[model samples]
Structures are given as structure tokens and as C-alpha cells.
Target: MTSQTEIRVLEISPPESLDSPEAELFHGGVDVEFAIAKQERGYTDLCPSAEEVLVSLRSQKYYKKIRLAAVAGLAGAPRREDVLGWASIDLPRHDNLHLAEVHVAVRPECRGRGVGTALYSAAEELARDAGRTTILAWSDHRDAPSTRGDDDSGLEAEAILRPPTGIGGVPPDDAPTRFAVRNGFQLEQVGRHSVLPAPIDSEHNSALLSAAEQRANVPETYQLVTWKNRCPDEWLEQFAKLRQKMSTDAPMAGLEIEEEDWDGARIRDEEDRTLAFGRTSYVTAALHVQSGLLAAFTAIETVARSTEFAFQGDTLVIKGHRGNKLGQLVKAVNLARVLTENPGLKRIHTWNAAGNSYMLRVNLDQGYRPEDVEGEWQKRLQESG
Candidate 1:
């Protein structure tokens, strides 16, 4: 019901630097993200800074980035010159070329004005033109996180809807949920966002580390190796293999994603990108003593400016090494080192697919509590004949 004269959607290019004039819209988009997070989740801890967002847009060797913004100044004055919304379409370059990940965000005041729908329309058209057949998107849900530890405020079960995974649920009336369903995207999977308070008790950490090491048969058959920022030359290839496995080994549920293509070069590229974002990485991997191969690995990233929290990245135990508790072993060792080095860190945040019970259990055992739910939505586009 909106007219073209009210607003305009245009493709945007990343500014050369944060100080550039074109950067205003990009920074405005980041502000919108922070505002949305704070309004829904009561905090903006998960939102990245403008510098980080620009760094990601520039580092597109692995994924092609297309950004669009809706400007509300087409007519005369008043709300003129205001950025109403932002959208991004990411297309993988190496593997999963058939997929396009689309994200759209509108300013809180711009809701119900057709800004979001216009942005999405432009983004999806670009994806189709690029030959992408699968579109993927995610929505954040902060109300009534379905966890045993959290209370749902007497909400009825019938009002909640679970994805095909049958693990987590979101309220049917949530704005994001309704918009996605109206746009033909199916709820494919759900992920639980969790946080672990830091300054972990040294005694408790030691006890958990001992139990995990014993379960992993560490030192006897496997050894834990920890590093920061960069991987050692000797273990780069093995580490790259673990990174490759993370793509396929993780639960996909109904997503049409494929195994990612990774090499030592890609690993080094990612490390460089992390540094450019003003972040530091902490990694721990389990090395098989006899084979000298990395059987499992985990990583955590922290921003230099905010030493208050860290984000937990991928943690995976290769298929052959599943039952040995290597996941917990690497996570514990890496976390212990991170806490020691960054004494000011207050907490760590991580997300896992709702169906990934083993990893979820590992996180739970480490004292991570449920904070929110994320819905993974997917839609298949009709191929052009």
C-alpha cells in the first residue's frame, strides 16, 4: 500500500573508510541493528560496531556482498533524507553457490510503512538474477525462550510453533515470524543462544577440565594444544581440515547448504579478517598423539575495545572421534586460557542448532544458560526457464 514517491531503495557500496560521507547510511544501518536488538533482547551486546560491519563487507573473498538501503527522502521535507531500512544479500563464492543469504532490517519508527518489504523485494530480485535457487534468512525471537530453565509466563503451548527439527519453538505472533511466513519462507531449524558468565571459578574449571581430560583420554592418546591469533605452520593443514568438517559435520536440518571449501589459505584469510575487525581469537585443538592429526577444535573471539564478553565460534569433533569427549576437552582448555588472558571478560555467548543435543549438553555442562531463540528460515526460488 506504499507508493514509490514516498521512499527509494538503492544499492549501496561500502565506503573506503568509516570517515567517508557514504558511510553515514552504513553506520545508520548498524545503529538500526543495535536499536532492534536492545528493543527485543534488552541488550546490544551481540551487535557489532560500525567498524566491524564495514570490515566484513570489504572482506568478501569468500562471500559476495550486496547491500541496499531504503532512503525516505523522495518527495519534499519532514522525514526526508532519513534512512528507513537496510538489506544485505550474501552469496557464497566457493561452495553452495546456489544459495543466497538475505537479511533485512528497518528502523523501529519505519515499521508498517512497506520499507522492509521493498528492501526484501530488491534483494530477492538480485539473488534470482545471480542464479541463486535457495534463499536463507534468520529471525531473532526474545519472547518465551523455550528452555527448561526459563519460565514462559503462562503462555499456551498451542500459541508456539516449532520448526521441522522439533526441538525449539517461537511464538506464532512474533513480527519476524509472521513476515517470514508471509514471504513464503519455511521455518527449517531453530538455534538456542546461550551465555556463560565469566570469571569462572578456578576450582570449578580445574574440576571440569580434569573430568573432560579423563573422558577424552588426554595425554595418553590425545593432547590439547592452545594458541592465539594465528595457527602454527605445522598444524595449519590439520586445522584447515577441521574447519572444513565444521561445514558438513554440523547439523543442517532442512537447510540446503553444502560442505564448504576450505584450505590453509582460507584459514589464514579468515584470521587476517578477524584482526582487521579489531578482534583477537583464541583456539584450542585436540591432537591425536599417534596420528598427529587434529581430531577436534574450538575457537573464541573477543573485541579489543570491549573486554567484557567473548563470542564462542565453531567447536567440532570429527566423525571418527565422536565418543571420546574431545568437544568438551577443547572447549574447556580454550575457555580456561581465554579467561586467564582476559581477566576482565564478563561472559561468553554461543549458539547451536536446537537439534545438536550433544554440543548443547556440552555447553549446558559448562554453565551456559538459554538467552534467546533464532529461527532459521528458507525458501526455494523457481528456476528461470
Candidate 2:
């Protein structure tokens, strides 16, 4: 007979890192759990590299600056080797300081026994203790019931992101979805996940880019500037402005997200962290030729070991600069750069608001294919529990 799962914190003092044996165990456990989750999602790839975990949670170079805390729970016992699941709260130093993002995973065999709930409870306590009132979390699943736009075969139609009403108080169909919903969190935003095959066929990609270029009729008054790792010192101020615009201008739909206050210093801090982790970043931006102002930008990140995929970060074209196809131009420029630099990278993954038809069309035109849907959930800790 299976034993009852017991959940509690796997605590380690500060100045500690996830590279420790206990952390590694939990890290490896999470990888195994992710593998199971992916298989369930019909994905064939392995979980994203454990290196990302170590870099995020264990990098002392990022300690007080980022302020990350981890907690793990065990099943039926308080042993390091018995980790049933674990969660981490990432409090980014520069932005979203008032917010904490909880990332959790449970071992495949120990799921459905409240192990995930236990980890979340522990994480919530940590957030509360840190004086954080805003908590953001996400749930991912496959084969979920499609809402209105679904075909008879259950394939979901393009969903438009709408403002959330309130916590449904209704039970969700899956354990993962229910964990957050039952805990009083409201679904704030919906995103569609898509992937673009990498090691891009240069001939085909060139054709796509040329087609977009022709259609954009990008004004002769604009020019493309590309870089790696960080923007030029001269461009940091305008670049920061674009980032702040992303917070409010991007389609949040119903999400109650506050504006992200980005500046040159914060941008520098991010670049430093990226350098410490030995990752590669590509940025492509449109410079208004005569004005010398940055009109829009797009970026992609990949680690040296990222042979399979690169994470697409942000692509934005300011309001006044819209209609120039700057979005497609910048994204296409960066995609070509990433393909050239990281020849082994075979795919690029990005998530977009379900209602973002403009950006979605841009991605589709660049050969991106829809893969899944995910929710960005939000909880006001003080109001709930």
C-alpha cells in the first residue's frame, strides 16, 4: 500500500545555494517531475536544463540582489531524500520587488496527494514573511477543456484575453489548475504558447524576412541596430523607456499588473546577471534615423548549452511608431542573429497574450506554430487566507 504523503519545508539557512546536495536532490526531482509533466503534455523534449535552476536559485552572485528563497516538502517523512515537491519564490531585485513569483513542481509518483498544496502553503508563508502582498503564479497543462472557440475535436480556438471576473470558487478539472483556483487566486491573463523551429533554413528565413521587409515599407527614415548582451550606453535610456512601455502598453487584458518601472540601472543589472550565467542575448531595435530615438526592440536568450531552444523575451513597438512593421522587422532581425550565433539552437519559444492578434500574426508569419495555452494567475495574499 502507498503511504500518506506529508508536506513541510526543506529548510536551509541563508548564504546557502541550491547546488548543495539537498538542493540538487530537489532540483533533480523537479526535472523528473517536469519530464512527467511534459510527457503528459505530448512534449518530447527534456525539462529545461537544471543549469537554469542553479543559475537562478543558487547563484550567490545574485543573492541579496534578487532575493530568492526555496522550500521543499516531503511525503510521509521529514527527510532530504524524500522530497515530494518543492517551490521557489523569485523576488527580482530591479523590478517586481513587491511581487513574488512562486514556481512549484511535484514528483510524478507523489502527485495528487496534496504535496503541491503543501509546497504552495509554505511558499505563501515565505511571501507573507517577506512583506510581499502580491503573489503571481502560473499553471500549465495539456489536453485541457477548451472554452468557447473549441472545435468538436477539442482543439482550442484562438482565445481573446479578457479581464477576470472573480475567483470562480468552482472546482477546476485538474489537480494543477485547482491548486491555485481553490486557494483563492483569480485567473488574470491567458497566453498562447508557440514555438518556431530553429537552425532556421537561411534561404527560407531570408525569403520571409524579405517579404516582411517589403510589406513593412519600413520608412527610409529608420535603421536597424543589433547587439549582444546589452544595449549601447547611448541607447539604454530609450531602451529602458520601451521596457516600461511594455508593462502598460502590452495587452494585459484582464491582468491586474502594475507598471514595471525600468531604467538604465535596472537594465544594467539584468545584463550583469546574464553575463554571470554565461548566456547569450540578441537584441534588434529600430532607430528612428533622423530623431535617433529607439522606436522598438526584440530580444532572445540562449545559454551555451541551449542546443534545443531559446526563450523569447520581449518585442515591442511604441505606439507612435506602430504600423511600420517594426515588430516583424526587429523580431526577424534577432531570429536571424540567434540562428547565426547559436547554430545548435533548434527552436525558439514565446508566449503571447491570447488577445494579441497583432503580435500573434507577426509570429505566425515568421513560422511560429501554436502549441499550448497557459494562465497567468494572481493572488492578493492579505485578502486571501
Alpha-carbon TM-score of each model against the true structure: 0.94, 0.82
lDDT of 1 by residue, 1-385 (tens): 3454577887777888888777777776777788787777677788888888888998889999998888776643222137778899999999999999999998777788889899998999999999999999999887645644654445566777777767677888988999998888999998888999977777776777899889888798999888899999999988998898899889889999899998999999999999998999999999899987889999999897698989999999998889988888888888888888899989899999988999999998888988878899999997322
Q: Model 1 segments beyond 4 Å from truth?
A: 1-5, 75-81, 147-157, 383-385
Candidate 2 per-residue lDDT over residues 1-385, each given as its tens digit: 1233434555433324555644545454455556566657655343545555445555443223132212243433233445566666766454566677877777667676666676677777888887778888877645433322243232222322222632111124656666777787777766777788865667776776776677556567678888899889989989989989989888775555678878897788778768767678889988887788998899998866646778888899988888877888888888888887777777788988766889988988888877666777888877886
- Any runs in candidate 2 off by more than 4 Å, and if so which? 1-5, 12-34, 41-48, 58-81, 92-98, 144-172, 199-204, 215-219
Report lDDT (Cα) of residue 62, candidate 2.
24
lDDT of 2: 0.68
Tell me, by lDDT, which candidate is best: 1
Taken over the whole model, the C-alpha lDDT of each candidate is 0.85, 0.68
